[model samples]
Target: MLQVISLVLENKPGALMRVTGVLSQRGYNIESLTVARTLDPEVSRMTIVVDVDATLRQQVVKQMNKLINVLQASDLTESPAVVRELVLVRVRTAQESRTAVLKEAEIFGGRVVDSSTEGFAIEVTGAPEKLNEFIDVMGSYGEIDVTRSGALAIALDARKLKLQPPVPTKAGVKMEETAI
Candidate 1:
């Protein structure tokens, strides 16, 4: 089964490498991975998609939490979340196919970001399946180049994964454990 795992990590060099290395060492395949800085510049969020069994998914989450740079990790497979991927496609356009291609692109909520006598560059953002369908339709028109941003997702409502700092005890010492 495919699972979406989200992680919040400290924004620092080699943080991504550590996370990916752990997964690679365990022989897990990453279907998609997207990372971007969060509103807080000190932190970054990563959304990773991997195909694995439920037990293995839990193991991956646990391993992620063991990393010092990883502040929070959560499996969003069954959670209420919003996910999307962006795709930019430049398609060859002939006088006979230009109108048809534009109409089809409009049906998928794609915009003509650029156009020339040779082709039109269409930008589309939506669920992965929608983008795949659009690509199939545009294939007949000829694709010159294509670039895609892997899936990015965030949980809905108050149900989200977050990092909390350890509380101080009566002894005046802060705990080292990370709060999920």
Candidate 2:
């Protein structure tokens, strides 16, 4: 099973290494990891995806939480959350296929970040599966180079379930937020 684990850690040297060390020491292979500073400069958030059985999932979370700089650790695989990834692709295409390449990128909602006589550099962001499809389409164009940002995810707000003042909607119809 693939488990998504989110962690909040103090922004200190080696904090990330320590957290990854715990997992590596246990022989867990991380599928993807994305880490960045949060609003507060002193803290950083990390989203890690790993393949592990149910028992191993529990052990990974427990070990992560025990780390000194780790403020929190939660397994988000079982929670309602939104997850996304970003990819950049540079494709070298023949003049005859340039138009088709750009058209395909537009259809995929990709932005042409850079362009030259040699090729086009496109940026796309969405669910990992969507990016995979986009990459496959881009590959058909010609020789290409690709780079990806690992998955980033956040759990939905549980407080949204509580009774509260009605949220205003643009067209007077209530809008519901659903996790992706």
lDDT per model vs. reference: 0.88, 0.88
Model 1 Cα shift for residue 63 (angstroms): 0.9
Off by over 4 Å in 2: 158-180
Cα lDDT tens digits, model 1, 1-180, are: 688988899999999999888789888898899999999999999999888777788888999989999998888888899989999999987888999999999999999999999989999999988999999899988756888899999888564556677876854433344421
TM-score of each: 0.87, 0.84
Error of 1 at 161 (Å): 5.5
- lDDT tens digits by residue: candidate 2, 127-158: 88899999999899889899999899998855
Lowest-lDDT window of 10 residues in candidate 2? 157-166
Model 2 shows how many backbone clashes? Answer: 0
What TM-score does candidate 2 get on C-alpha atoms? 0.84
RMSD (Cα, Å) for all candidates, in order, is 5.8, 14.0
